[model samples]
Structures are given as C-alpha cells and as structure tokens.
Target: MNVDPAVPLACEPANQNAGTALQDPEQGALSADEYALFASVARVRRVYAGETLFHRGDLGTTMYVIAKGAIELDFGEDLIAKSLGPCEFFGELGLLIGDHARSADARAIDDGELLELRHEEFQRLVEIDPTLVSYFLRRAIMRVVFNEQSLIRRLRRRNQDLQSALDSLRATTQQLSRTEALVRRDELTGLYNRRGLLQHLRERHRNGATSGLGLLLIDCDQFKRINDEHGHLIGDRVLQGVANILRSVAGTNDIACRLGGDEFCLLVKAETREEVMRYAEFVIHTSHGLLQMPQLPPLICPMSIGACLVCAEGEWNDWYARADTALYRAKRQGGNRVEWQDNAPIPA
Candidate 1:
C-alpha cells in the first residue's frame, strides 16, 4: 500500500511506468511484481471527506478503487442516494463500455485514499492478466445484477400499494354518487325534491345563457277537501298519479319537483314561448284525464297549472315568485285550466 510522494495529483492522466517499486502498502496492498505492474499503470490520490470525487457527467477516462473510508453514489437529483464502503470500486463499467461520461456522481464520505487507474492502462492490465480480469468482472457483474433485482422488488411493492389505494378511492366515489342521488330525489313521488329543484334553478340562473327558462307551478284543486273525504292514503295515490303524468310529458332537459304536499313545480328549457305554452297545456290536460282510484266513487283528479317565462335579468327566486302568482290566478279562475303570467286568456 506504500505510494510515491513525487507523483503529482492532477485530474489528467500522467505518462509513467506500468509498474514501479514501493516500500509501504498504505497506497494499496500488492506483491513486488503486482506493485510494479500497477504503479506503471496507475497513480494514488488522497481525497478529503465531503468532497466531490466525480460528477455524473465527468469524463470516463479513469476509474477508482477505494483504499480507505467510504464514497457516496448519486443518481439524478437525489441528495441521499447510495453509499459504497472501503475497498469498493466504481466507474470501471463506464470505462469498459466506452461511455463518454460517468452515469452517476461520486463523492467521498470521509477522509479517504484511492487508486486511480487510467482507462488505457487498466485495459492493458486486463489483457495481460485475463484470469484476474475475469475474477473482478464476474464480481462486478454480480453486484450490478443484485442491485437491479433489489430495485425491481421495491418497484413491484410500490405498484401494488398504488393499485390498492386507487381501488379504495373508486369504491368511495361510487358510494358518494349513490348518496347524492338519494338526496336529490323525493322518496314518495320518485321525482326531484324541493332542495334539488332549487339547486337546479340556481345553476341555470348562474349560467345566464337563456336557451329558455320556463317555470310551471301546479297544485291539485281542492286537495284539502279530497284528503278530508277519502283520507291520506287516497291523497298519496293522487299525488303519485300527478307525478307520473308530469314525468311522461316533461322532456329530458325539464325537471319535475314535488314542493311538499300537493304542490309541484316543473322547470323546462323550451326553444320558444309557444313551446312552453304547448308543454303546459299538455301537462294540464293529461293530468286531469289520468285518474285511477278504485276505492273512491268517480275518481276525478284536477290540477291548476300556472306557467311563467323567466327573464334572463331576474334571479331564480324572482322567476319562482312570478310562476307562483300565475298559479294562484289559475286556481281562482277554474280548477282544470292553464294560465300564463304575460298572456291573459280571452273570455269565451
């Protein structure tokens, strides 16, 4: 391990004998002939702790064998990468493969000694001592293989964990979707509830793009009288019947909501005012015609429809109030008739 003090420490390779005589083994432990051969081919250098020996993109003209202390190897931008202890070597693969630069950064971890061998000199030694070359090459190859296997195992475990987390997220999303649907829908009539209707109206108002905002507020004529005469069960059936008619007549873009008791609201996106009037008339006519009650004598279900066209300038609440006023007017005039807020019907 004895090294010559006369050898200048420089980053570049120096021309010297492939082997030379040395007194001590601190530079590297080698027999007389081995020392001569290596001395002719390589030079020894002392490195300080926390010093960068080589960077990731440095020229691959030389390789190092750690005589003492430890070195750290870094890949990419990682701060704490991998470490190599004393007697370990690195950068030989880059030299052997004719790589232009080092693949990873190497730094000394502690005050250390290293044997730096020039690429040409090392290749010459490998050619001369084939057996020694084969021994070191086999060990290096095994080390690389073991490292790759360890990396593969870690990646597989990470992938499994990620997949499990994704599955859990998917299950939670499905459960939330079901809960939201239940909240929006009325249980008794199977229509959208008042809360859902308000939410829809607010969203439409926010958009402010008037395709056609129409609201119809419908109430069962004399609903209290029917409930008093037949009981609550018959009243429930009447509500279900009205809901069915609304569902059948309303378009996909339209929403039918039961605003509790016998009051219902229909929000429609009609192309024209005429289309809105036609839809209102259809709902009023159909709801009055379809009355199925076997328990009561002469089952007749009538509804008062109050329809209004919502202006783009008005709020959702303002539009709802207008529709409510029209509904009251229809109820005052007659039971089974439709009334519009803007257009009053002529006396026949």
Candidate 2:
C-alpha cells in the first residue's frame, strides 16, 4: 500500500494571500535567509474543480501544497479513496523514492489553489538547511512508524476477538444438536416417541394430506402372558426388537414409535392402498421371527396390526381411533394378521 505524504505547510490559508514581501519564511519563525529562499522558489498555482492535477504512474518530480479547497484521490471505478482539505499535501513519496511517476490519481474536488515546488528548488532548500531537513525527516519517519505499530496492534486484537466468537458458536451448535435428538427420540427403545410422531403427522397434514397416509397401531398378542412367563427385562428386549423391525421396513419419510408398553404406531405417506398393504405385509412377515435369549426359550413375538388411511377432512384422533379399533378386532380373531379399517378382509 502506498501512503500519502503529510500536507505541506505552505498550503495553509493563513499563508495563502500573504503579501509577496511578507511571503519570506522569516515572516514567521524561519530565519531571514531561509525565508528568502522559501519565497524565491515557491510558485503559486490555481486549479478548478473536476480538474485532474495528476494521474497514477505519472512522474512525481514536483509536489504541491494545497492553499485552498480539497483534492480527491481515486483508486479505480469506486470513489473509495479520500479527500485532502486545505493545508494538506500529497506526492512526497515519489520524491523520497526518486520515482518519476505517481502511484495514485489526484483530482481537484473544488476550486483550489496550490503552491508548487519544483524538484530542483526543493533539493536546493534541503542543501542550504541541513538542520531543517533533518528535523522534518525525523518527524516523518516517527509518524509512519507509530501509525504502523498502532495498526498492527488493532488487527491482532480484532483477530483474537473473532476467533473467540467462532469457538462460542461451534459449542452452541453442538449442544443444540444433542438436544434435538433427545427431543425426537424415545428414551427406552430409541424409536421416535409419541410426541415426535404426532408432530410429523401434523406436518404431513399441512402439506395437502397426500394419499397413503397409512397409520398402524400394533399391539403384542398376549403381552401379559409374555411378561408373566419371562421377566420385564426380557419383555423390554422384545419391544426394542419390534421397534428395530419397524424402523427397517419403514421408508425414510415414515415414522415408527413406541406409544407405551407393548403398543407401537407407524405413520407412512403411501400413494395407494396397495402400497400401504405391502408395507403391512412386510411388518407381519418380519415379526414372525423369534428372538433368542440366554435364559429363556426362543420367544415367538407376534403383533396384531390394524391400518387406516388418513383423509384430509378427518381429525388426527379420528384416524388413530379407527386403526386402534381394527387392532382390537385382529387380536380378538387370534393375533398375527394385518387388518384394515375399510372392512377389507384381513390378509390370510
């Protein structure tokens, strides 16, 4: 990045209209000889608004001191650059580097006047007054170094603050993820809980209630006998095994949940009654397989499943109750069969 030079002293309005006789540097703090040299060499020039004083890559053999108004700097298409008011000077970097061209384009933003100094005249002044040259050069170097150090410190602090913010964001995201999983899952079987399944049903209802909204309520046939024969621990394992079977057979958009005890439910968005039946058959056929236990004989766990298709006008409880009644009828007719509430005969 190129840094502009500090504004020149001759640019000050107080110094602008000073009579030629008093234009001598000695008129202020300068010695008589120094004032004579300053006055003799400096030339005043006027620039109008919208005028281009210089452009990037132009030779910078001379510098200007703004006497009045402002100069604007343009980097490119954008006016992101700044303006220099009266008493501000630019273009000294070219002189210091002995470069023939400028690094940026300079334009007059308003009608302005400048005191121009040729490279030769500036060099002559420096030669005659080493003390003045040394003082100005030291001040310039100190200002540049101090500004650089301050910028570095600010950047470092900002980077540290940004890193800390990112860490906090990451931690918060992890915690939310774990919480969401817990909210949607059944603690015992790791299947979806009743609340989660109901939430999914509501979402489906909002999406135009497409066909094949099949709901099934499954009840273990003679669950009380199983609990009496084996322990609740074994019964719990059986329930979990049932949940796993339902999860495997269900589609990605389907939901399987353990309502409570040995009762479970499934929700699927099927396009037709046949599609619903196909899934029901899979569940029935898969549940026939017995679960093995160390202390108990192979348990042939069977489920009586009843299914119903959801209609757009019906309430959520209406579909559930109809399916649940079908489930009871299936159990009454000797378990382990798929029944539909539409009076379609249970699959043989």
Candidate 3:
C-alpha cells in the first residue's frame, strides 16, 4: 500500500463512513475517512502475531496506524498498559519529533496490517496541511501531560507513607528506652536498684575510670524487730526516709542504690580512705538524727556502715567481700558506727 503525499491528516466524525475508526478514550474516535486519509499517505506493513513493533527507549523515526488485528502498548514500572484494536494509532511522537525514543514497547497480538508513516512522509504531510497537523499534535501532547501528572501523584503518596513509617519507628524506640529505665529503678525509693548499680559499675569499668572510688555498704540494725512491731506500710516509709538521707549526703559523682531489703550502698568518688570513712560517718550520724524527729515514726534501729576503697588491682567481688566483712564487724560492735577495711590483697 502507498499513501499520497498531498492528502491531509485530520480527524472526522466517527459516524461519517462505514470504514474503521481510530479510537481514543479521552478525545473520542476519529472517522473512517480520517483513518483512511492517514493510511492513504503511508506505506503498509504486515506484522505476524506476537511480533514486536517497537521497544521502549528505541530511537524511532516512524509512526504506526493499525488497519487490522490487535496491538498492545506496555509501559513498564507500575504504569498501566494499553490495548489497541483496529484503526488506533501509536508512535506519533516518532514522526512528530525526529529520532524520538519510544516511551513504551508495542507488540502485535494478532496478524495485522499497519500504516507506517516515516519522517519524510510526515514532513511532507505537515507542509501540505499545517493546520490539521497542529491539531493532531495538540491532542497527543495533552495525553502526555495527563500521564506525567498521574505519575507525580503516585510518587507523592509513596513519600507520605514512608514518612509515617519512620515516625512510628521513632515512637517505638523512645518507649523502649523508658521501659528500660523503669526496670533498673527501685519502686519505693526512686533510686537505683541492684541491677542499676551493676550497670553503673560496668560502664565505669568499660571506660577504665573505676579506680580511686569508695563503696559504703549500709545495713539497718534490728530491722526485722522494727518491722514486726510496726506494719509493713511503716517499714516502707522508713526505707524511703533512709533513701532521702543518702540522697542528701551523696556528692554529684555519687550513686545511691538499694540492694534489696534493709540493705543499701553508696558508690562515691574518694581519693583516700579517710574520705570514705567520713562518708560512712556522715550517713550514720544523719540517719540517727532523722529517726528521732518529732513528726517522724519512732524507731530504735540505726544504720551500721562499712567503708572500703575500690582498689585498681581488684575485681568487684573482692571489693564487695571486704566491705561485707567490715559491715559485720560494725554490727558486732553494736551498730550506729562506721567501720573501714584496710586496702589489702584478697585472701584467695
């Protein structure tokens, strides 16, 4: 088949002739006359079923107008595909813009006859009928604009979804941190528990800063007798009062911890054994004075304290054993007193 160079390429009403029409969902269909006009000026090519007409990104210099059978246009990457039947046209961009790259892969699903208008023929048609060619260009450009807008909207929605996921992750992280803090705290005293004390020591040891520190182990003398006479509610209040006293005497670098029932310890920064002794004395004196206050509950028990300097050459177990021995000595000497363990090598 051959097309006359003088024939105009313009759309007509779909009902004008009994010939096949070019279908476009957005702009409606073109009349059989218009389809014939394009075919008349173009070269005819036969394509077999399952034949590829063109591929995406292939530089194209010709446009195809279908006369028989079905063709499919596949634009990958989440874009919707298009199916075209008889009288539909595709690849217009190739003829309009010289050497234009195809945007989609076009394949024939059935044996078909297509009207292929090369760049030379398109140029001659434009010269013969500029007004009709301009109208055709406007319609094709509109379709391209619509597709671009649809892609932009999809990208925007995806970005918002990603942001929401990130926010949810951050909230979950913060909640986990708060839960960890509660796990390491004493309920009655709002102070570090035994677990927290170990964690603090581990951190300091990791930084190699555990040397020149003091550990003061304290025990409430006759605590069981006091609890037996007073209710457990009063016992809890007494513990809270002892915690407050420890808090008041502790320095900025000190850590006050409750190591379970009737036992507490203070980890303080002390350069000499004398400093450790002074801390133990201060705790014993303040605790005795506080128990005798008129508004507070009357109690006969006193705090027995043992002081030991944390040796650079020793482990935490060694330091704890020596301090515990000193604590027993203070209790044996009848409580309300401070005892110190001289820095010495472990017996084992």
Candidate 4:
C-alpha cells in the first residue's frame, strides 16, 4: 500500500532567484488605476522569524502576495516545504474560491512582509478593472485543474493494482478446489474411497434434499477361493474388474465406492422397489462378465447383489443394515442372484 510521492503541478513554486527589479516607485508594471486599487484594497503585514502566517485547515478567502524577505509554505502531511522571496506569489487559489481552507501551512523563515487582499475587496477591484481580474482568474483555474488531473492519474494506477491482486486470489482458490477433489478420489479405481463416500452421504443428508435414494451392496462370491488357488496378485485383478463393472452400470448421478475387500456399493436414486431391483440386477450381470476377461480367469465365481429402497428421512446406518441383510441373504441363496430387504425378486 505504499505509494511514491507525487510531483506537484508545474504552476506550483520552483527554484527562482529573487531580485530588486521593482524597488523603485515607478518600476512596477501596474497602470495608475491598478496601483490605486492595489493600495486601497490590500493590507500589508510583517512577520518575524518562525511566525505562522496561516495554518492548514484554517478558513479564509484571502490570498497573499510575497512582498519582501523570505517565507515558506509547508505541507506537513506531504513533507514538502517551498520558499518564496520578494515579488513571487502564493495562495491565489483562495481568492477565487469561497470559504476556502488553507491546504498547507505558511511561515516566515526570516523577517518578511506580505500583501493580502480579502475576497470582497478583490471583487470590487475586478469591477473597476475587469481585464486585470480575467488575467489572474485564468492562471488560478489552470493551477487547480493541473493538480486535480495529477491526482486522478495516481488513483487509476492504484485501482489497476487492486484488480490484479483480486485476480491472483481467484486463481489460488481454484487450484485449492482441484487439489481437494484429487484427495477425495480413489487412485486405483477412480471411484470414491470409503472416506469420500461417507463425506458425500453426510453432505446429502445435511442438505435435506435427497429423495428416492437407493443403496446397492455387492459381494464377490467365492473370492477367497480364487485368492487361495491363484495368489493375491490375481485377486487384486478381480477387485479391479469389480470396479470396472460398477462404473459400467452406474447412472450419472450415482456414487460408486469400494468398501475394502470384495465389498462394493452404489448409491443412486430409485423411488420404488422395482427400480432398485433393476439397478441391482444390472450390477450383478455386469460383474458376471468379468469372468470372461483374460485377467480374471481365476475369478470365475459370480457376484451377489443386494439392494434397499432408501427412506431419505431415516438414518443412513439403518438403511445400510437393510442392504447388508439383503446381501447376506443373496449370498446364502448360493451366489449369483439379486435380493432386497423390503421386497424379494420375482421367481424366474
């Protein structure tokens, strides 16, 4: 949030060598009328060293013209101070403005003198000498415009920097979201892991919008027999086949997960017992095809599938128990078949 100090407008003071060119009575370039107006309408004041002519934030409508010796304008906030000697002018901006506050402090560096004109007296001089009023008015307005334009440029640069910071923050947030998704995914199967599945179910329950939710619990029949005969490497291949089968049968909205060791489950939407049975049959049939694949030669046993019609309002553990009970029954009925807890499959 640090910003470089701004360069002031060209109309502001610059280094200048003071001289006594206007010391003589007739040397100043004022007409007889202007001289009379200047003397009558202006007041003269003198200050000793370190004397304050005006303080910032003080209200006034007078502008001072430096007459003799040396004085300086100091802006404490900007840490700027500029010296003015004889015949140089400052604070003309106040004369053209109404009820103006000094933007900086004015103090004497040495014994100095200044000529000040109140706004009302200046207005009367303008009436008497309209051309002279026009001369100073144009210069005063140009100084104000230049200062304001410089401020605008600084503000625009600051706004651009803020926009760039916001864009970087948005990019960082997107990267974090992608990283979180990778953490939830199962590396081998590309399905949700058990932890991921539980998190998903909790979110769904908290939302209270889960309707027609269904659960399918599956087990590979005679899986231990295959591992005993062909070794564990071949057993891992059979588990991978089960993952593929679940992927094939899953609907777009369904969440399929491997719950470790020959057990898999699919969560889906199915309002009726018939719809749940159809999904269970699809999964069982797909898993049976894995036996034909060359890598699953030892995995010749069929899969057992059990399904439950989920009640969205009930606890998920109770619903899962129903599916487990159905899976136990299907396995007891001797492997490759579908069963349900609330409703049984029609005899074929």
For candidate 4, lDDT tens digit of each residue in 101-161?
6657999999866667787667776666554444344434444444434434655644553
lDDT of 3 by residue, 108-141 (tens): 9999777788877776665665534544555554
Question: Tens digit of lDDT per residue, candidate 2, span 206-277?
Answer: 886545578888888877787888878778877887888888988887888988888998888776678777
RMSD of each: 27.1, 27.3, 28.2, 28.3
What ordering of candidates by lDDT runs from best to worst?
Answer: 3, 4, 1, 2
Score every model by TM-score: 0.51, 0.51, 0.54, 0.49
* lDDT tens digits, residue span 181-287, model 1: 66678888989998678767667767866447688888889888888888887888878888988888788888999989899988888756687788888887676
State in Å the error of residue 164, model 3: 1.7
Global lDDT of each candidate: 0.66, 0.65, 0.73, 0.66
**For model 3, what is the alpha-carbon lDDT of residue 15?**
46
Off by over 4 Å in 2: 1-157, 291-300, 343-348
What's each prediction's clash count? Answer: 13, 7, 2, 0
Report the number of the highest-lDDT candidate: 3
Best by TM-score: 3
TM-score of 4: 0.49
State the local distance difference test value for candidate 1: 0.66
